[model samples]
Structures are given as C-alpha cells and as structure tokens.
Target: MSADEHITQRNSSVSGNDTKGSTEYQTGGIHDFKTQPNESCSFTTLKSNTDEEAAIPLMVGDVHLAEAQELWSTVRDKAVKLRMDRSGLGSQPPMTVHQMFMATVQKFGEYPALRVKKDRTWVTLTYNEYYQHSRAAAKSFMKLGLERFHSVGILGFNSPEWFIADVGCILAGGLSTGIYTTNSPEACQYVADDCKANVLVVENNKQLTKILQVRDQLSYLKAIVQYKGELEQKLANVYTWAEFMKLGENVPDAKLDALINSQSANECCTLIYTSGTTGSPKGVMLSHDNITWTASAAGHMIKLKMAEEEVVSYLPLSHVAAQINDMWISMRIAGVTSFAEPDALKGSLGNTLREVRPTRFLGVPRVWEKMQEAMKAVGKNSSVMKRIISDWAKVIGLQASYNTMNGVSSAPWGFTLANILVFNNVRKALGLDRCRACYTGAAPITKDTLEYFMSLYIPIFELYGMSESTGPHTMSWAEGHRIMSCGKVLNGCKTKIDKPDADGNGEICFWGRHVFMGYLNMPEKTENALDADAWLHSGDLGKHDKDDFLFITGRIKELIITAGGENVPPIPIENALKEKVSIISNVMLVGDKKKFLSMLVTLKCNADDNGDPTDDLTPQVVEFCQQCGVVASKVSEVINKKEPAIYKAIQEGIDHVNAKATSNVQRVQKWTILPQDFSISGGELGPTMKLKRPVVNKMYQEEINKFYSE
Candidate 1:
C-alpha cells in the first residue's frame, strides 16, 4: 500500500545471490521472471484459460475518437505523475488506461494472454489472439445494437471471453453490468433488471439457466450471447459465441477500426456491483476516468508500466479491486493479462500459474489463506520441517524485501540453496514461484498467515479499501510491509479515524477523487456512506498508529457488544482460527447481548484432491470430541441439528480453544464447533469470504443456547 513500494528490478552483473556494489545488500530484491521458462517451454501446447472474468464494458464511438485520446493523455499524465512520486523513480509518460492496453497488445502478442489446460495441453490466447478475439467479438456485439454507453449484463467466472466480451461491448460503445457467477436466479434477475441491460453475455449452461428462469422478467433483454460455445440447453434469443464471432468477421475492418477511433476516455464505461454486506448490492458506476484515477493513485509503486509484464486475472471482476487491477489496470498499460484456465478452480489454480508466470497477482484474503493452508497441510506432520520452513521463510522474506529494495538479488548462496530446497515447494504450491508481488484486500487478513507467506520470498502487501471509495484507501508499511495493518493512505486519498473508542479505533473515513458520484437510485444509503465532505465512511472500524500505519480492526457493523460492555470484533478471531485448527473452517463470534462473547465455529470439509472418494470426517470429529472432553453423543447431537448443539459446542470448544489463544480477547468463553464448514459453493461466506453473519446466526439459534444456560 506504500506509495514507495518500489521493487527494484534485477540488473546484469547480479546472480541470484550477489549484492550491490558491496557484499552487504543490493538496492532491492528482483522478481526473477527473467529466469522463468517461456510459455512454450511447458510440456504441452499453450492455450486459453476457462475461468470467466466479470464482463468488461466495450466501447464503440460514432464520434470523438480524437477527443477520447486527449482525455487518455490527461489521465495518463496523472498516472505518471503519481507513479513517479511513489517509486521515487521516473516512468515513461503514462497513457490513459486505454492507451496503456494498446501498447501492451503490441509487446506481448506472441506470449500466452489467457490459458486453460485440457487433455494434456494448455489452451491459451496470446496477445495477438486476444486482440483478434476482442475485435471480432466487438463486431458481433455491434450487430446486436451496441452503442456508446448502453448497458449489458455480464455473468461468468474469470476468462478470456469475459475480457473479450467486455472489450467487445466497450469497443462497440456499450457499458457492462457484471453479475456474480454464483448468484441465484432471483438475485440474477434482480441485477439484470437493476442495470436495465439489453444484452447479457453469459459464460456457460449454469449461468444461462439463471437467465432462462427469469428471461421473461427481463423485459429489456434483447439478446443473450453465450461466450462458452453453444449452450447445452436451448434458451430464447440465445446466440453461440462462435456464430457471434463470425458475424463480426464479415463486418468491414475499416468500420470496426473507425469505431475504435471514436472512443472517449471520459465515457461511462462499467456499472460494477458491490456485494452488499448488510443491504442489497448497489451498482458502482466507473468510467475510464474513474478507473484511471483509482489505478493512478498506486501509479507504478505497485507496478511500473512494463509492456511485457504478465498479470493473472482470477478474482471476481464484479468487485472494483480485481476489475481495475487485473483487467483495466493491465489493459491500460498493455501488459499481458492471463486468465486461469479451466472452470475447475483448484485444477486451474496450480496449472495456470506455472504456465502464465505472471509478474503481478491480486487476490482476497480467502485465496491467500487457502494457499497458506495448502502449504501448512503439506508440512504439518513434521515439527522440524515446520520450524526450518518458518525460519527460512522469515529470512527469505526479509532477504527478498531488502534485495528488492536495494535492487539486488544478493541472497547468500547458502540461503538460495535452502530456498530452492525448502521454500520452492511452498511457492510452487501457491503457484507463486513466478510472482513478483501480491496484496490481499476486501477484508482484513491475519498477520500470522501473511507473515508466514512473506518468509517465502513473496512480497504480499496488505491493502484496505472499499467498493464505495473506488477501491484502496490506506496501505501499511512505509517500506517493510506490515503484516498487521493495511498500508498508509494512498497518495491523494485523505483518511482519518472519525472517532475512536477506548482502543483508539474508529470507522475509517476516506475522501478522494476515486470516491463515487453517489449510489444509482439509493440516495439515502449513499448519503450515509458518503459524508458532506465526500469522504466515504468505509463502515469499517480500524485504528491508526503514531507513524500513521492503519490497522483495520473489524467491521463496524459486526462488533458484538456483550452485557458486560465488552465489544468483540469477530473477524479477527475468526480469521485467527481459520486453518490454524484443521477442524474449523468458518467461525462466527457470537455472545452479543449476553454476559460474555462466545463463538460458533464451523468445521471444514476435508475433501480429497480429486474429490473421488470424499473424505469421511468422523474420525476427526471423534478426535475433536476427545480433545475437548465433550462427549461424542453431545457432539453428534449438536452436529445434526444446527440449532440444538450450539450451547454444548460453544462451552466445549471454548475450553479447548482457549489453550491455543494468546490473550483474553481471543479466548472464547463458550463456543459451538459446528457440524460442518461453510462451503465456497454454499452461500455461507459472501463471495469475499466475509461471513454472512445474520444468516449464520439465524441458522443456529439452538446451538447458541448452551452458553446461555451457564
């Protein structure tokens, strides 16, 4: 989050273990993408990824292409100015996000743009291929009445077509409304209607089903374009992705090029929906200028404008963070952006990583935590292995940080050997072996998990932001990344703790150019979140340090005040228990309006890698019963009935969970270790991994009973 997060690139005359002019340290550590194998170097043919990105709005200009270019120049200048200030290094004059994308298309055209593995090979799109795809798709959308600033519905996972669809929509001068891929039929119906979309670019059969269910409800829907080939189930007004491409193929190239020429940088680009934590989601309208402002704040402190730099796009695009960073940010600079291949998440996660070898990656805490859990699972059985891994992790992290800061790769030869032998496995597991830098946001992440990863020589920066505030507000670590806090305030973004509690924490309020114009229809909600001064009250509680380091404490709405006047911020404790205990997955801190705060802990599903023979978790439950001195009968009773077991589990897990707690704040006086974990496919966790507290609390009224009786 630091404006000065300048990672030094490795220059010649430096080995993986050489220092700067002296033997002490280099100016900074370098990301060794230079040493990674080319896309073709992999065992199979390079191909495209299947993970669908949230739709990007395409543009078509019947007027003012030249003016758009000027706007691009203005925004580009802003980006360059901020980028230079942050890195303390100069950058080539920055282009508008649009101008940047044009440059990137030319540089890495031959490299894999997005890819997926199938049958034994990688299916991918190089930059040239992606450009062709987008242009053709744009032409097709043009045939469907595409015009500047018209809205379209986009529902899918992260993929090249998603990008292509977005670009096509934009190239044809249309805005896109991105809906969550997992949204239910009703929610999907709600979003499509809310956006007033005329066309919907869908991913596959599942997405099509949701639309099909409410096809009649969407009176404005004129066309449905399927990006994933033909649909297995027929639906009204549906067009296959290939047929649409062919429609664009015959369209005059001069006409298509002319459309591209007319784009305006200030045009309304995308209607991004923020996932509602307390209320129904609202559309956050972002323009080329709005997006340009958001990305420019980081400038090149996070990444310099490098044409050949590869970025992997995997996070939910509906959200502003990933949409701006992965698609808009990368395209603005014309860097090679790859999507994870395969609809299957776990499969694509590992394989796509090795193939893409991206220079920048952005993800939420859940994704990062999963990577950490994966590493711990690989080494948990051996204490000696864990210790060595931990020590080497811290050293390599600092070494990488120091070397990166100094612009050197001077890891001691001894350290490099250990890294290769011990740390590489961990890095490879997270598919981060080729990563340059990463940051987790959308929620607060634990210092322990982050610090654990930092040791692996991967510089994972923690950032805090919101959908309302354009995205990032404050970033921690002026120099060395802070594991405990989101970084200091971004350049040009003013942040202050509006009010503090006894602990010096308050809701973080942010005022910036990146802040929203207002909610589309919900003026009251908009007014509450945005103040008179235009600072977006994040609705998140956090505290700041004397040095101005901002540590996000918890969500203001989620704090549970007990009868005794103790306020429990659930997320920190829930985050603390995540993966620390193999049995627990989703945890909710309850006990509000009660004598003391307690917890309701949910167990994770221990599925096999292939999920062929699903893991039978009875033994683990039995062991938990033994560990906590709770009877297996009581555990079984509470497990089956979500309501019935809360009290016993709360009381029992609390006693046992305490042995692991470091302080009174974390110690659970009572808790119910649930029968099962909140699943990804399940709606228990919002897409962002923040708990749906009200839903969970409602589902287990009886289980919370055990603590009340005592």
Candidate 2:
C-alpha cells in the first residue's frame, strides 16, 4: 500500500498491533494509552517554563496597597502555585477530539459511555457503540458532501443524539456550531447564516419549525436533519436521522479514516456563540488544540478520575461550560455522561441527580440558588427539633468550610457529630452524596449561597471563564479555595490585571493555549477583544489577593458612576442586598451620571398556580409575609403599595447593606419593586439566568425615572 493508504487503514480499524502503546483490554477491544500521532497528523504542545522560579511580584494598585500588602505578608512565602504546569500531570495531552474519543473508547469500550431516557426506561450506550455510531454519522455527512473545514450547526437541547452529531461532524473534519435551543428564530438565523453552516441538525418538530421560519434566508443551508419525529411537511432538503444514517451504509470506513487522519490540532473545530448581553452574539472560533489543552489543564486542576466519574448533561450544549464539562472533559477522562430528559429537567433534575449520583456536577448560579431556596423552605417547614439540629449542624459546617477555604485541615469534634447528624443527610437529600466536586460559574454566586452549601458539607467552587477562553480560565480547586474568590489561574494559563484603577480592580486579561482562534468573520471585534500580545481583554473588572485568588468585582461597562464621580461596582452590592433580603429576586442598581444611587427591584413570586398569581401564593411566600408580620393577599400588593411594614423591612435591609458600604455613593438612595420577576422568556434574563443589564434598564426606565423624581 502507498503511505497515504497505509495511514488510512491504520486509522480505520481498532487493531491493537498497528498503534504504539496500544493495550488490549479484557473486554475484547484495543485501547491506545500513548499520545501517538497518525502518520499524516501532527500535534502541538503548549510551551511552559515549569522549572523556573518566577518572582511573585505584588501587582497591587495604589487604592489596594494597604489591604494587598497585609494579605501578601501572610502567604508571600508559602502561597500555593498560581500557574500549574500541564506537564507535571505525567501525561501527554490529546491533540484532537477524535484522538480523545478514540483513546477513551480504547480504554473503556465495554463501559457505559452515555445514558438517555427512552420512554419510561433509561438506555445506555457503551463506549464501543458510541464510536461506531459516530463513525456511521460521519460517513453519512461525508456522503452528503460535507467538505473539510465546512461548518455544521446543531440546534437542540442536551441529548445523546446531539453528542453523536457533534462528534460526527468533528470526525468528518467539519466544524460544528451549537445554536441555543431557547433562542428566537431570528437569533438562530443569525448564527446559522454567520457561521455559513451547510447543514443544520435539530431535535424535534418545534426546532424544525424554527428552521423553517428562517430557512429562506439561510443561503448556505443545504439540508435539515431531524433527530426525533417523522417528516411532517416533507420540505425540500429535510431528512430524518434514520434516513441520514442509511445514507452512510453505502460509504466505506476508509473515507472517514482518511478524513480523521488528516486533521491537525491547530485547526478550528467549533464555533461557540456568546450570550449577547452587550449586543449581537459573536461566533467564537475554538481550535482543537484549545479544547484539548483546556480539558487537560482543567482535569489536572480538579483531579478528575478516569472511568470513575459521572456527570449529568442539562446545561445548554450551546454554552461552552457544558461543552467543556459534559463533552470535552468527559471524553478526556473516559467518564460517563447521562443526558437529562428535555422537557423534564426543571421538574426532575433532583430525581435525576439521585438516579445518576454524578461524581462531577456543573451548575450555574441560578441552579445553586434554587437548591439553597429549597433547603431553606424545607428547614422552615420542619419540626422544632429538626430545625434545631439543622441549625447546630450548619454552625459546625460553616466553621469547617471556613477552615477548608483558609487551607486549614483541623475540625472540632462537634463537626464530626454534625456531619453525621445533619450534614450527611442534607448531602444525600440533594443527591450530592457522591459528588466529589461541585462548580458554579457563568455568573457570580453570592458568598451566602456558597457558605450555605458548605455548611451542608458540599463545597461549591466558583469558576471564571468566557467563550473566548474555552470555558474556564480560573477555578477554585478542592485543596485551596477562599470565600468569594474564583481561585487561581488554571494550569498552562496566565492572567494579568490591565490598567488597574485606584481600587486595584481592572480589566481581567488572560493569555494561554486555551485562548480562542478569533471571532468568526469579525476581525475588528476580534481585534478589540484580543491585543497585539494575544491577551484576551475579558471586559470584566477583577482583583487578586496575595494568595493569587481572583475576585471579580463587576463588569467594567456595568459600573455605576454617581454625579459625585464615585464609581460603584453594582454586583457586590446587588449580591449583598439579595443575601440580606430573601424576597428580592433580582436587583439592578441605577445612577449613571445621577445624583445618587437607586435600584429597580423585583420580588420572588411563587403562585400555587403557574399562571395565576391571584389564586394563591406559595407557602414559602406566605410564610415570609407572616414572619415579617405583613398581611397581604399577594406579595406584589405589598411591594406595589410600598406598605409601611414591608417598606420598613426593605428599608432596614437596605440600611444594613449601606452600613457595610465603603462610601456614600455605594449606598442605595431609593428602590422600587417591580410587579414581577425577571425571567428568560420575558427577555429580562439570559438563558443562564444572568440579568441582562441593558435590557433590564430599558425595561424599567419609567420606574427608575420615578425614583429619581421623588
């Protein structure tokens, strides 16, 4: 055979003898443990200075000099390493998604790879079957003339088919773009057109209807493949998944082998669109090298165990956070991933958690907040004895969490008793008994919420990253974490604060192999995001302590500047206010060029009926009013009337927050409660439950104006 054909043949089969360091598992499959390159493929390793002792300079601005220096004095000599080396993990990183997938299949072929709900039962896909099915899908794409470097769009909720289609496109040497399932048709059209995707795969008839609405505008769209449901309208260029897979039966494996073998690590593999809080979403181009390096680095930071970990897939696949944790990192670690039912996530996530008992779980701040709220409700309704025990356990847990955050190992005898009496049951009830690591990111989580979970013996780590950095750049690891800190930079990543203000807060900039290639077809925007030296300007204001833990203050553009010219970061104040007052669902501080700071607040309303607030309020809402000694049929009435009792409570909450404020500009001068809460469907909140500041400000402009006028 010719050299090219030899390479193609070697890549096609799972024969152990052909590849170096290939081990034959007892389960009757070949697993390659070494990071060997195919004859036609090459890989790149990120450069690092592992052995050098770099100076730990205090990068503090004038405003933070005293505090920074004081913190620095404690850990200047014994601080944990800020930048860990990937090489120190004792393994060569896989270069491409295909490489990682093949290695995982080789290592755990008979092990369950994916589990999905089928009617009333769960269906499992083993590693061997996953690889074979992906190959089949790739063959089908090749039959459809999917050329190398072309783009394919996947629009759907988290499902096993989504994972199959994504890997199929990558294995076929085409880049895949995921469109948010909750996005409007116009938004979907923008992503499909901007990426120039030739084929779009959607979940069901509803998703297909979205494509049909905008199909006329998609010039490059050649075909639409539906993973579920039959052909309803019989539109042109629409194919059912069964039909698509049948198309692959005629195509040979050699074609896919050659395609996979020709791939390079430096090439772009995926385009993840931003959430578009500021403007239209930008397509972030991420190379295979970026994903692989991030997976390896993050795995090292969190110490993910291979074949011993499981994770639930519920977060939108369009988001990079889910992609990294559920797809890339899982593949790298050869771990199992279970898909949550599409329509049942909100009602069944807790049940699913108990069923899966995932060792690693990733949740946004909202999910954690809901869990905390549920715990609070349970505590409220429990008997006096249970409440006392819970409170006592919480006190012990809080102390234990504090010690853990400060890197101290000792715990009092009461802590062990509390763990057995209350904390352990709490963990089991939340289905986090087996969870080794729980992470919250995508937005800032309140310190109160973090400590609440910690008191339950479940430490929730805060991670920081964006689409431009392959999901996570900094994360609070298990060994060394601090309250309110996003932890140190990940292994193989470098972070710096640029143009710090007097308060030492500045735009958080990062440089590493994990940085994205650039925004798709938007060179000017990409240039604005990345500087000449390749440091990504994150557009987030943050500060770092002497121990190298990162603390995000707020968004640079969202900072509220008072008429007196004092700049106030709203996030900390908003978080503090929410922590103090449980009823305030969302808060947006306003005072840009105004005399004083004011806020537009929204109340948390849980009606007994989903659509009828007048019918009855939830027990928790009623209990809150009763505890405060306010008599009202609806929580909205108290807020709308600004009733003296509730108003006094709110004012006391605000005053308490102001007491902790460092300056008068940071204090809330006034606030007005909205009739309803911010929600994703209402456009006030992003898909991840992050408040869209611009949208919210415009929405309550009239209410905000009234506050200033009064």
Candidate 3:
C-alpha cells in the first residue's frame, strides 16, 4: 500500500469509539489517551482526484469513507470564481471548518492535536477526540437555543475549551465571536448585545462575573458556561463546563450533522471585532472560505508540512493573527498545538516553550522585545570569558544571517563554530531550537529587535494584515525576507497601492477571497472599508520596494500635520528614537498643528501582580543605568531626582536620532519620560499591544502642552 493508504487504513476505524455512551467518553480522564498511545493513529492525504466523488462525502459523518483525496478540483473551481491564480495547491474541494475538521480527523484520528498541562502531567486530546468533543459541544449549543446567524461570545485566554467552543459554534450554524479577556463589563455587554449572542463561554468566574454584571442588559443571551471554575453562587442559565457538555446528550448527532452540512463556504461563519482604539468596535464578518482559504494559503506559502508543524498557543485568539496562526492553520496542516499557561505573558511563556519546543512560533513585537530584554539581562551578568565568546559568536552569526537573507550561499569564517558554541545554545535556551519559522506581527517590530535576534541566528519574519482581510495578506518567509519589510503578498492574493505619492507610498488595498463579507450591520462603515469593486482599503500607508516587498509607512489616521502644513509620519521617528535609546519602552510623537514635534517616552520597568506597569526598573534598564554611572532602581527615583547621568544618556541618544531626521517637522524638540510604562491594564494599549493613540493623547495632554509652551 502507498504511504497515504497506510495512514488511511490506520485511522479508518477510529470514529467507531465515539459510538459509546457520551458519559463514558466524558468521564474518561487524562490517563485514557495516555494508555492507548497508538490506538487508531494515522497521517495521510486524500485519495480522490475528482471533486464530485470527494464532495459527495462533505455531508454528515461520511468524512471517514472519502479517504484522503489528492485532487484540488473544488479549490480550483472556487479559486477561478475569486479570480485567484490556481497554479499550486493541486486540486481540492472547498471546505467548511467542520468539514475540514472531520476530513482531517479521518486521516489523523490518533494524532495529538491539543496538549495542555494540568498540574504536573500533560493532557493530550487526539484529533478524533477533539472532533467528537466539538460535535458534542455543538449539540449542547443547539440545546441552548442558538439561532442561525446569532453569535456565541467566548471570553477567555487560549485553551482547549476556547478552541472547541469556537469550532462548535460554527458547526452549529452560529457565529463564533471572541471577546478580549481585558474587556470591562461594559465592553463585554456591548459585544454580547451587538452580536445578539445566545451563548457566552467564559474561562473562569472572573470572566463569568463580567457577563453576570451585564446579563440583564443582554436581550438575546440564553446561557452562560464557565469553563475553568466552580460556581460560588447559584444562578439560572449558568452551567459548569462538564455540565454543559452533557446537556447535548439527548440531542441526536444526525441533527447536528445536518446543520454542519447546511453551512456554505461563501457565507460568514465567524465575527472578528476590531480593537476599537478610535471608536466603538465593529464586527468584521469572515466567511467559511475566508478562514479555510487563508489558512491553506498561508500554510502553503510558509511550506508547513502536514503532521509536522507544532506551535505554542498564547497570543489572544480574539485577534485574527492568533486565530489564524494557532487555530486555523493547525487544523489545516494537522499540527500539534500546545496551550501555554495563563501567566504566559508575565514570564512563564519561556518555561512552556522549553517544554513544548514548538516547530513554529508567532509572537507580537512586545513578546520579542521581552525575550530580547531577558537575554540581555542574562548576558550582562555572565562571566567575562563567556561574554567575550558570546560577543564573537554574535558577530559571526549576524554576518551569516545577513548573507542568508540576501540569498548569498557563502558563510563567514568560523560560522559553523560560532553556531556550535553560542548561537545554538542561545536558541535552545529560548526554546526556539526546534522553531523553523518564527513570526512577528500585530504591530510594528523595531529593527533593533530584529537585528538582535538575527545576531543570534534567528530571523523573525514579519506578517501584515487586518481583521477585514482575515489575518495575513503578506508574509515574509525565512528564505526571502527583508528585516523591516512585511514581505511579498501571498499567492492567490493581490495587493494594490492606491494613488501613490512621489515616494510611491499610498493606502494599501487588498483583493482576495480572504477579504471579509463586510462589517456586520454597519453598511456605512463597511462601504468605507470595502470599495465598490470589493477591494479592501486598509487605511494604512505603505509602499512596495523595487523587489515588490511591502513596507508599511504609517496609518493615514495617525499622520501628524504640523502648523507649517508639513505631513509627518510618527512611526519612523518613534522607531528611530526607541532604537537609539535602548532604555525607552514606548514613545508617542505629538506635533499635530504645532510648530515642532515633541514626544512622550516611557522607561522600561517591571509589571505588578495586576499586570500593571510598576515603578521599579527592569533588570536590563537597571544595568543600563549603572553603565551610565547612575544609581537608580526605580523609574520614579530617576525621574524625580532628574539623575544627570541618566538624563544625559537619553539626551545624547535623542541628539543622535535628531541628526538623522529627514525634516525639521519630524525632529523632536522636547520629550518627557513617563513614570510608568504603557500597558493593557493602564488603558494605553489594545489587546494586541498596538498603542491606543487617542487614549494616550488624552492621558498626557498636560505634558504635551508643556512641550509647546516651553
């Protein structure tokens, strides 16, 4: 038999186990999967070359018999309609998320799909079990009176329950919406009411309490399910996760299957609400095809191998990048996804990464910066001999990385020795030893962070997209990536720079099946986003290089026009300042309608137990202060004392950046360092760590006015 056939034969009988009573399966603990490690395992592609034969089983539960099909006929047909070029990807039928899950489980039934750490032991859920559980959850959702096109709002961190609830809602013909964990009770109510949510899935009592506070205001909410904690107080229509899973026992599988079969690839199945940094959050409607096609396209572009990719899930799934990278792409390629702890952002992420040793990782810019800071702190305390060796290795590693990025085959002298001595150890410490592709997106990453990682032989590629475009539109791969550019557009997607200036910068527009089905219930806003021809105007300024690599310049809404009528993009100058001054954590430029530009800067500091930025300086920042001959351990001390050494160092760095400014309007005339760093809890950053410009402006209006007065 062929390799594919061997995989099919192994998994053909796996779904039979689900015929057992629901309680029997539900009662099984973590030990059940552990005992039957090899039971009904598989890894295979489809066998069919024709669309008709393959799609015949796209109905309920017949995914097992279809065998792994080889042809992309259905995909090709859909591609033609979307006007997408269909050269690669062979032949395959378009699939709903449910159909895709079923088909994948049929081939990889016993493969470890979701792994979560409980206490000290690792719990595994095979692909088949994942499907069966999601199906059960779908029935429960139907039992809870979920109406077609209504929403199921999930509020939580990344976990197995979060993933299952999202998929289950889609399978039950309801919109799956993710609400940020940091959202207040009012924000939670707005999302629930706006989507007309029939069900809300909370991670714990913390999230559950938010729903309960506004439950009276939610007209369409029928039930609330808390996945993580016990009920301290009895409330009607609220159930524990275990109790909720059993509610669907009486609901037949055939009924749920019919709903799944009714789903069309072209219709919206998911809702992504924007961060609403400027205004109220608007839901961006994403079709079944948008998720499946974009996942497949992105995976293909990055050359993700089937059943080989492994990733850590920590970023907020409410954001499109995390949803696409951690959930959808894993489903597409049958990759293993391990959930990180709730405190992953605070510091525990490193421990989880070391344990999981994922093959692919995606992080926002802040995550990368944190890693950079941690490593620098360690290096600062290292022995003199080790530091010397590390410095030499880094020089060699950086040269090798630059050469590879430029498509040069030649490596510098002692490159192999350097990797063996320092580069490899550094990667292994960061738990990136197995990571083949590391991605950074959701915000602009500094060149300093990029080059810092590159010196250690890890190239962090950039991804560019928005919720309206269904995650990633342009991707930078390891082989052909530029440091600052967001890389080339994905295959089957077209990018247009609408009305370029003399510098070739313009509003970036997108055209693809990945373009969303317009903002939910907001035609005016939808019309503003999607033009008449269905092209998505991103409202971001960018330009393509001669090699066609896209570089984002700035957001049109964020452009600062000075009193002299000069247009200035704050990002370049902001990035320059941060790069020049290593101690600066965040920077915001202020000069709109003013004579000259000024800035609000924040120092690097530690976060408190509540995730709020504290006055205490971080280790790296403390070391920098010592280097500058200043004795200070707190941001308040440095600012209050106006420490001459620290101030002199910052001023010197500012002068260096000013010397390189392109125009007088772009130069910083004055700047003030804030006492605390910007953070999510402080209301200065969005969920994905994108700066909330208007909020920051208002918070520091006094300081900003002082700059102009002086």
> Per-residue lDDT of 244-363 in model 3, one digit per residue for the tens?
999999998899888887666655688899888789999888877778878877877777888888999999999999999999989878899999999999889999999999999999
**Candidate 3 segments exceeding 4 Å error:** 1-93
- Give one digit per residue, the lDDT tens place, for model 2 in 553-648: 888788888888887889988988999987777788899999999988776666322222232344666677787787765756776667787677
- TM-score sort, best first: 3, 2, 1
lDDT of candidate model 2 versus the reference? 0.75
- Tens digits of lDDT, candidate 1, 1-710: 12223223221111111111111000122212122211111111111122222122112111111222111111211111121111111111212334435545765567666665456676777778877788788788777776555667889887777888887776666676788887888888888877777789888887887888899998768889888856786656688877667876668878877766655444456777766645687877555445665665454335334455677777777777877777766664546666665443454576667666776677777677767666655564568876776676667666665565345756644666767666677667666776667778876676666667666766678877777666776653326345576777765445657667677777777644455545556667766776543446787877776666777878767888767776677776776555355455567888888876677866544544542212244345445656666454333454665433334554444565567665565567766656556654556676666678777777788888777986
Model 1 residue 362 lDDT? 72
How does each model score on lDDT?
Answer: 0.60, 0.75, 0.80
Per-candidate alpha-carbon RMSD to the true structure: 11.6, 12.0, 11.2
Clashes of 3: 12
Ranking by lDDT: 3, 2, 1
Best by TM-score: 3
TM, every model? 0.75, 0.86, 0.89
- Candidate 3 Cα RMSD (Å): 11.2
